[model samples]
Every structure is written in C-alpha cells, then in structure tokens.
Target: MNASLLRRHRGFSLVELMVSVVIGLLALLFATRLIVSGEKNKDAAVGGSDSMQNGMLALFSLSSDATAAGWGLNDPMVAGCDTSFSDASGYALPAMPRAGASITPLAPVVIQSNGANPDLISFNSGTSQAGAGSIKLFADYTVGNTLTVDSKNPYGFNNGDVMVIAPLTPGSGKCTLFQLSGFGPPPNSTILVNSGGAYRFNAIAGLPNPYKQNLAYIYNLGSPTLMHFHTWTVSNGVLLLRATELAGAEAAGVSVTDNVVSIKAQYGFDARPPGPNPYDPTPGADGMQITAWSGTMIDADSDGVAGSPGDYQRIAAVRIAVVARSKNAEKPNSAGLCTATPVAPTVFASSAPAGVAAVPVQVNVAVAGDTVSWQCYRYRVFETIVQIRNAQWRP
Candidate 1:
C-alpha cells in the first residue's frame, strides 16, 4: 500500500525538467529580440522626424529671403551693375565671383557655385519706407559727399538712411552706395553723406564717380542698420549666414541650422517671349515667361555676351534644394558596410519643363570628413521654386 502511494506522487524525470527550462529560455530570447527591434525602429522614426523638421526650417528661411530680393534695386539700371561702396567699418561684399563675372552683380539674387560642395547665395534688398521709387537729382552730383534732390524732404530721406546712386542711362555700368549723414540747413535739398555721427558706411572720400543731374537717381534704402544684404552657405554640416550690413567684414558666419549636407540652386530664367519668339523684343520688360533653368546665367536674349544685364534681368525665379541628413548614424550590417543609405542622393531631379531640353544642375552628396561613411546616413531633400516677386513687379 505504501509503495503504490509513493508511485502515485512521484516527481518528473530530468529530461522533462530540461525540456521546460529550454522552453522558458527560448521565450526570454524571443522577448529580448522583440524589444531591441522595436527600439531600433523607434530610433529610426525619431531621426527621420528630426531631419524633416530641420529641412523645412532651412527651406523656409531661404525662400523667405529669396522672395524679398532686389526690393529697392529692381530697376534695370541698378540690378546688374557692378556695385561699389566703401565702409568706414570695414564691411565688404562677397569676394567670391559669379560664374562668368569678375564683380558681384547687384541683382536680386546671386549664386556662387562650388563644385562638389554647397553653393553660396547672396540676397540684396532694401527696406525703404517710401517704397522703391527713385528720387531724381535736383542738380548735378559730381564728385562730392552731398546729393541734391528735387525737394526739401527728398522722399522721407532720414539722416542714417542708406542710398544707391544709379545712373538712369545704364551706360555707367556701375552703382555706388553711401550713407546719408544729414541735410542742409533749411531748404534741405542737399543730402549730406559726411563721415560724422554713428554712420559706418560713409567713407571720408565720397562718391567714386561724378553722377550727373537728370541722368541719375538716388534710391533711398531705409536705415543703414535695416539694409538686407545677406549671404547664405553651408559649412561643416551647418547652414551659415553673413550679413554685410550687420556683420561688416566678419568672415566667421552666424549659424542658421545644422545637419545640412548640401544646398543646390539654379536660376529659373524667363528666357523667351510670350509666344514662339525665342527672344524678347523688349529685353528688360515685363511679360517674359520662364522657359529654361541653368546654373550659370546664359545669354537669355541670345546677346553676344553671356551673363549680360539682359540675362540678369530675366531672372524671375530661383529653384533651390536643401538636403538635410538624419541626426543618428545608422548601424552597419554583418559585412561591416552600412546599407542604410547605400547610394548618393540626387537633387534638382525633376523632369525638364515643357520646352527645355534638360535640367543640368546636379548635386554631389558625398560629404567629406565624417567618422562614419556618408553612406551610413539617411537624407531628405527639400525643394521649392521661389518667385522673385520684387524683381518681377518692378517698373
């Protein structure tokens, strides 16, 4: 009776216990793998979101500035001229030359291309309170620090306002920038650019050339501190800005955004007339349509010289692509190479516009000097075409 009772309550064998332990271990291993996989996916999602946010911010900043370009300088005489100015504070315009020009054109937008790297874009505009209208010189302004305007008020010209002296004839091929210091005693037709007060842009010498009366106009560019002459570029995976009016001669740029690998841009040219005519009968007139896009400003009107004033006047829009990279470097595979990116990204890849043969703009995404290979990262491309409204609507 005792033996039968013991047999009925006997424990399980070693093999059965080992099988249960193995099952428990297998369950734990599966659960651990599931958690790791979920974490990796979450990381990837977060990284992508960061890239998207940064890209949008970068694009918006650039587009906003591009839209307001050539505000007070939209006149054909002022837009493409080689602008010259001296600053007492040592401020200087960008020394990097345009593709085919020696001096920087005083246009709405100027793009300086750097092969296999990010491009530099400069935006020139004025914040004049009296709008972008020009005030004719009352008398000849020949080789002096003072300008004689039509009336005493001179279109709300303030003491510290910046002004551009543009030749109405366009034959001078040059524009000069100066700061307004004050006005003559009572009937203030004499605008002074004297080197006194807190002015920084006025040089002691005065205007570089003698601007003749009835052939030139003084364009008020609001306060000297409010002038918008900004240059944008990407360096060391960050977007940077240098304002000629603010940061005067400071080569170290202000940081705009980070994780940006490249910035590619092209000029959207209104190269043709309204109908089938290849050239505009009126070169610098309105009603021109964007027929092609290019990196270097070409002879849009088939003029003898490329990057002529007519070519610059036809710049109605700019197409830009800003590339932002994921913050986190992706993990590598068993072969010790990252397959996350695997290939370089292409920019300005949209199909050619209706009549254009091809969009020749290309972007190189192989970033240099990274601990991890550039292929081990993910990227996002933000693209948009910003119209130069100020340029387009100018009279």
Candidate 2:
C-alpha cells in the first residue's frame, strides 16, 4: 500500500518540467525588456532638458555682453575707427580683412562669419566713471610727449586709466590705445603716458604716430582691469569666450558652456530713416527702426561702399541663434544609422522684410573627428533679438 501511494505522488514528468522552465524564461525576458524601454525613455527626457538649459545659458551670456558693447567707446570718433592696439603683456585683437586693410574696428560689436560653421562675435566696452567723454588735445602730441588737455575740465582722468587717441574724423586714421600715468608739472593740464613702471598697455617705443593737435581727441577708457573686451565663439561642441581684460595679452579662450554646436548672427540695420525723409544721411536717423537684416554690414546711406564707418554706426541691433545638442547620442538601428534627427536645424526661419534678400544659414553638424554621426544626435536652436541700447542712444 505504501509503494502504490509513493508512485502516485511522484514529481512532475520531464515534459511538464521543461514546459514550466520555458514559461519562467519568457517572463524574465519580458521584465528585462520593459525595464530597458523605461530607461531609454528616461534618458531621452533628461537629455532634452539638459540641452534646453545649456542653450538658454549660452544665449543669455552672449546677449548680455553684446548689449553692453560700445559703452565707453560709443563716441563717433572712436566707435568705427580701425583701432591700432599693442599689449606688451601679449594681448592683441584679432584683425579682420576689410577693404584693402587688416583692421580691428572699434565698433560696439563686430561679427566674423565662418561659412557653414559657427560665427565669432566680439564685444568692446569701457567702464569709465567719467562716462564716454572726450578732451581735445591742447597741443600737438608727439611720440613720448604728454597729452595736454583743458585745465578747466580734467575729464575725471585718474592714474592707470586706459585712453584711446582717435582721429577727429572717422576713417581718417587708426585709433591707438595708451595709459595715463599721471598729470604733468603744475596746473595739471598735461596727461603723461610714460611707458613702463606698472603700465602694461604703454609700449616702450611710444605712440605709433604723432597725433596733431585739434585733429585728434583723447577718450578715457577707465581702468584696464575693468574694461569689457570679449570675443565669443563655438568650438568642438562648446561655447568659448576670449576676454582681453581677464586674459591680458594671452587672448586665451575659456569654456563657457557645453554641447553648443553653432552660433549664427546677423546685424539688424536701420538702413532707411523714417518715412518723409528716407534719404537722411545722419546717423541713427531712422530712430532705431530696423529696416534691414544682413550678415554683413551694408552701406545703409547708399554711400557706395560697404563696411564703412557709417555702415557700422547704423548697426542698431543684433539677432543671434545658438544651437545645442543632446548630451548622449541615440542608439543606432540594426542598419547602423540613427534617425534621432532626420534633418539639420534651421535659423532665421521667419520671412525677411520686404525687398531684403535672405541669407540662408547652413548648420554643419558633422563635427570632424567625432566618433558618432551627426544624425545620431538631436539638436535645439535658441534665438533672440537684442537691441544695442548704447547705439540707439547715439545721435
């Protein structure tokens, strides 16, 4: 009776056991697939958020600096002159080829375009306590001599103040940078620019040219350390800033943000003045109304020359677009291609003003030496139109 009972209660047969094992394996596989899908979705959401944050930051930084451009250098005599600068400490402005000369314009903002790549924009301003005021030279300023000014008004010049000696007329000559060492003798009418002795801006030789009296004026640029001369660019999927004040003559670039692939910009030009007087030749005649948008400065007044000082003066605002990419690349399909981003992003999507030709901006996503194809990554574009308040305030 015991033997018969034991046989009846025998464990599951081999076929039944195999079927149970198969069911367990199938359940385990389904759970793993579900977890993997959830993780992928989480990654996508996080990456999108990160790209948005980074893009906003880059736009803000660029806008803030660009808005402050030409603060101390806004005077007509200094704003658009091709400036000649030298820093014994190794600081120098990158020159752009204009007309038949290589010049660094003293305009509020200067944009350098890189076809199919990111553009480089530079912002220059001053932190003068005395404001953007100029003092005419009382006498001819020879090399190694002092700059004589009106004794009645000192213009609030202090020792170590960086000064720019610009031509009385724009485009006549190149502006030069110097430092005010101190007042000369008594009456304190003369400003000294002696080289050496803690003055890094002053060249040992002297001014590049002897500025004639009344033909040139001296504009105070305040302390060298407080000036704002910055250049912004995108490189290797990152935004960078090269500041002359912070880096001295080194002109070394500091990383600003990550995953920034490109920066596209255009000058908002007040080409035509208000109706009833469309041919006004006076600067800022349009009352800051943007009549045209262009990647390069145009001859707004029909002056027969592009990129002239007057053209630069008509730059009332700047429009910029910054592109940011996701932190992690999406997985490729079995065919070894990713469909994360089907097409390249577009900038300045809106229709341009009437009669204005639109310049299409082509964004290059295939970064050289990148392991993953550009199609594997997703991108976002942040754009803003920032008015140059300083330029608007000009006459």
Candidate 3:
C-alpha cells in the first residue's frame, strides 16, 4: 500500500513534462492559425460585398440619367434656330457645344477622358410639365427683352431659371434656350427674360427673319430644382452627380455616391435607314446595334458636315462601365501588386461594348501613403446599356 501511494503521488519527469508542454503549445498554435485565416477570409468577403453594392448604385444613377437624355427638347431646326443663352446672374447656358461648356443639349450624351482618370458624363433633359406648367403666350412686347405672362400662369419661375421658347406654328422647329432674369410677384406678372448685357433672347446666334411671333411655347428648365443637366464626375475618391440648370450657379453640385474608382462609357450609334417616318432615323431590326463605341464623343448625326445638329439626333444607346474598389485595405502594401492602371478595351461591339474587354483587366491602383496594398483589397466591375428614350425619334 505504501509503494502504490508513492507511485500515484509522483510528479512527471523533466523529459515527460517538456513533451506534454510541446503538445499543448502545438494545439494552441493550430487553433490560433485557423482563427486568423477565418478572419482574413471574412474580411475579404465583406469587402467584396461592399464593392458590389457601390457599383450597382452608381450604375443605377447613371442609367436613370442616360435614359432621360434629350427629353422635352424637339429636333432642333437649322433654318432659324439658336443654341446660346444667358441670364442676369452671369450664368451662361449654351444649348450647342461650346469650347468648355459644362452643359450641351446638342450632344445630349458627352463622355470625357474615357480610359484615363475617371470619365465625366454630361446628360441633358428638358422639363416635362404641361397645362399651367406649359408655356403660354401672354403679351408679345415690342421691346423683345421682356414678356408678360398671364396672372394664371402657374409656372412661377425664379431668377436664373433656364427657359426654352419655341414657335407653335405648324412645321415650325424654331426654338431657343434663355435664362429668366426677374419676374413680378403673383397677381401682377411680368417675366424679365433678359437683363441687359448679352443676356437677351437674341443672344441665341441664329434667328429667322421676322423674329417676333405671338404663339410661342415656353418650357421652364429648372435652375436648381428639377434636374435639367446631369454631370457625373469623380473627385477625391468620391462620385459626384451634379443636378442643375445649364444656367445655374456653380454652388449647385451634389455628391451622389462613394467608393467609385472609375467610370467608362461608349456611345452606341445606329446608322440604319429612316424608320416609318422618313426623317426620323431609327435603329434597324438588329436592335440599334453598336456601330462605334467611342471613349470620347462621337458625332451622332453625320450629315457629312462638321459641328452640325445631326450628330446628337442619331444616338440610340450608351454602354457604360463602372469600377469600384473596397474601402478597407486587407494586406500590406507592396510594389508588385496594385500599381498598374487598367486599359480601356479598344474593341467594340463583340464584347468590349458589353463592358468585357478582349483581355481580362486587373486594376490594382495603389493609393498614395496607403500602408496596405490595393491588391490586398477587393474590386467589382458593373456594366449596363442605357437606351435614351427621348433620342429614339427625331421631329
């Protein structure tokens, strides 16, 4: 009984204790490694999910704007039409393309710097309000500078509002874009269309002989209210969607979304014959097939003339690509991984127009001063084709 008690009370030997400690340490290390790997994978999944969400939102916003392009504005007439207008506030709105005009109605779809940096898209639409919202001829003043509206006119335009004036005569396509300078309050009504200085309605460049017409229709293109011109651009890692009148003050830009690294757009032109309507050129049975996908701007209507209105009239669809990156960095920054800029696919129609490049593009842009490598992060690519509803037909 004494010998048995001695053996039971005995502690482990030095060698046996060391082997037991080693086994315990190995098990602990294995568990820790497993946990770390799981956490890393979880992070990667969450980052990928965030990028997908960002990409979808950005694409939706872009699609909505592209669909609305060219709404309300009719096929412009070259006989006696003008595209330039300004208001008393010094905000210049040009319906036609100018050297640096931020808003251009002639080219309803404008893409800038397609592959390099983030591309800029400027889409234009007209206001769609009728009855009280519609333009009415109240009093045709001889001065041509001021026009009086009926007290019942409910449009209630404010200063710096962009307005479109069109002749209501049959077969008349004469229209002009102007800015509302001042207006009299409610009961008594006078709309000051121009406030001196190059702000007059005639500033529209080309007006037919015998300009003053009684039956004129006016459409209010909102200043900062309803968006008339949409400019999508990226600044400092943020995607901004600015909604304002072409004649609005510079203070009206609003940020739309974030985490959008870049946006690429290609113009889809349909060069088929005229539709049921001889003058209205429509995309043929092949479904407005893409003739050319331009990284820059393409003349929608080519009447074999330069700077003509025909270009904007033929645009049927737009193919857009939006790229998003994870907001968080998961791994250490390195020289090899996230340094190359993805090139825009030069191929058109087959797969490039669909936003798939002939070659798979891996964009791992390194952020300056970032400790984590961009390659250690996740990315998503979103692409969609938007057909301009208003641009489907020409007057």
Clashing pairs in 1: none
Which TM-score value belongs to model 2?
0.90
Give a tens-digit lDDT track for model 3, residues 209-249: 22244566566655534546667876655677655543433
Candidate 1: tens digits of C-alpha lDDT, residues 56-171: 99999899999889888777677777778776655456543434557756788888877557998888889997767678877876676777877787767888888888887653
**By TM-score, is 1 or 3 better?**
1
Candidate 2: deviation at residue 66, Å? 1.5
Candidate 1 wrongly placed segments (more than 4 Å): 1-25, 87-91, 95-101, 138-142, 186-188, 244-251, 273-286, 357-362
Choose the strongest candidate by lDDT: 2
Q: TM-score for all predictions?
A: 0.86, 0.90, 0.68
- Model 1, C-alpha of 347: deviation from truth (Å): 1.4
User: Model 2 clash pairs?
Assistant: 90-249, 91-249
Candidate 2 per-residue lDDT, tens place, 255-366, comes to: 9899999998888888774335333344443366667887776777567777777777788888888999888888888898899998898887664555655566768866
